[model samples]
Target: WRNTETSPETLSDSQLRGLGIVEGADGTINFESGIVVTGRVEKILRRDGKLMLIGFSNCSAKQGDRILFDPTWGTFDMAVGERISSVFNGAADKDAYNQIALVPKDRTIKVPSDENRKKLENLYAQVRDIRDRKVGCDRLGEIWETQQAEHAGDWLLSMQIFEILDEAGEQNDLKQKIVTFLNQKKLTNKDISTLIEWGFRLVTYHKVGLQTAAHGA
Candidate 1:
């Protein structure tokens, strides 16, 4: 937090990996800086742009480092929050820190109280910093756009391939261009397989050029 540089390129792979972080591994993704907690992945969710969890609060929890869990099965994160809130107005959403998990308690008794809720609110409000949440729909749209474009490209390549099916003229050149474009789009394994299988052949891909009339090009 002291050195104010957020450029991701600033960190090397080893640096990030050293923090128990791995790229492209799907699990809990911590986009914000906060107390670094490490444990088996538990329930993770987004509530009002704040990433939340349902694991034991004392489990290797720290303050001011981004953390990711492998992901867990449960509605505990929200369920606990809402249940506590319902019983005694435990945690308010306006202040992101007002959550159920942060409540300190004895092992025997479990009851909601305003004082404990306030403490949690005050504690996280001062300590933890939740970042903005990313929209899954937005990411989905990006995938769609890239896929559509690739679909279009395959059609174009098919035309080229069809013409040069019997000759090497310009084939390797077009093939190289296609490879570069595919990498940029981050195509999935299945997408790559399908593209490779029918990319140049362009069977079901859509054409993006001008539609031809009876006497058009």
Candidate 2:
């Protein structure tokens, strides 16, 4: 059995490529494992949703990574035989299975619908916001460790900024934090830049952020 926590034992470059999941003819990425997350093709983004690739979001899933469908009574073992246009690896495109035409493993149902898309988006937004705050806290912690007490106070405020962001429920709400800083007018350009840089770095390194942007579903 493969360990999902640590990286699964390496399957070798060629072995991985040869796996039936590499890329499907109809873009229905079938894996050796039976987990599936589905959604509308949002836009395929690159480098973990930082850039564009074949994308999908707000759909359904099942088994292993199955956040969408629940195969409690049946299995997705049956082949549907529907053709997908383009197949790519990574999470962003996974949702495309809904927006684009797809032959499910069972081929019993058509791709997901707009209703599913919206529902998924709502979930996605909630999760994404949570992840973003975590990233911010991580960044603030890093900067805090390096600064002197004078600068430390502002960084401390940054931590509280995240608290407010958490309660606000949206990224736009971060404006209040920025305004608070501006009103105090205490932070230097260097400090501001450092905070922004660290925030991005935190997102790059944090698992939750990566999962949300990359997979969308």
Candidate 3:
């Protein structure tokens, strides 16, 4: 690897290929220059059963720039050595990559199949009709803090929605924030609906401030 003005942790073609940093494969994420990319480890060239070469399948990146992957699904323009370690070690908190989706280089359009749709529907149902025994009363307290009901019937329904998608790690963090709102005695059914709508909007539409205003904290 040619040593540039970049850090030693910077990714190389050989290293990326070893880690499966393909355009469509799933695995750790990093930056080449400034592009956010996924790294798919195909082989661990380890000696004595220890990991060595981390291969990649593809890289969904543009330039050979470098960026640091924040475990919170956020990225930093400048690379960080520790973050590279975290990516290789798999020590980053799971929720950090929650909001990240499978991004391909081609940016193709995909429609969910019936089975997939049904599965999503089931997840939605879980959030909507949360049972004490199912979702656990203890968990509800933690999930209520992130909900708001400014638009009437939003917060409550939103909580139900979160209960469904709680399996989604990022959404779970967001739900936990909502649950915290509930525990603070600041949530109402109306507020919940508004908050729920906002939550969905943020997830599906990516509207700015949707999550912030909902939390009210």
Model 2 C-alpha lDDT per residue in residues 76-181, reported as the tens digit of each score: 2211111232111111222322222222222132333456434433433443444455544334333323322323222323433443344444454454545455
Question: Which ten contiguous residues of candidate 3 have the minimum total lDDT?
Answer: 85-94
- Please give the distance, in angstroms, between residue 14's alpha carbon in candidate 3 and its true position after superposition: 2.8
111-197 in candidate 3: lDDT tens per residue?
335664454344334444454335544444333432232222123334444544553344556566655654442333343233334
Question: Per-residue lDDT for 70 in model 1?
Answer: 14
Clashes by residue pair, model 1: 34-64, 34-65, 35-63, 35-64, 41-70
TM-score of each: 0.19, 0.20, 0.22
RMSD per model, one decimal = 24.1, 18.5, 16.9
Clashes of each: 5, 23, 62
TM-score for candidate 2, residues paired by index: 0.20
lDDT (tens digit, per residue) of candidate 1 on 1-217? 1132433324444544544434333222232434233443343333453322234322333234211111231111222224333322332433212222332121222343566556444432322221122122223223323434533422222222322321223345444554555555435344334323333322222221112222374
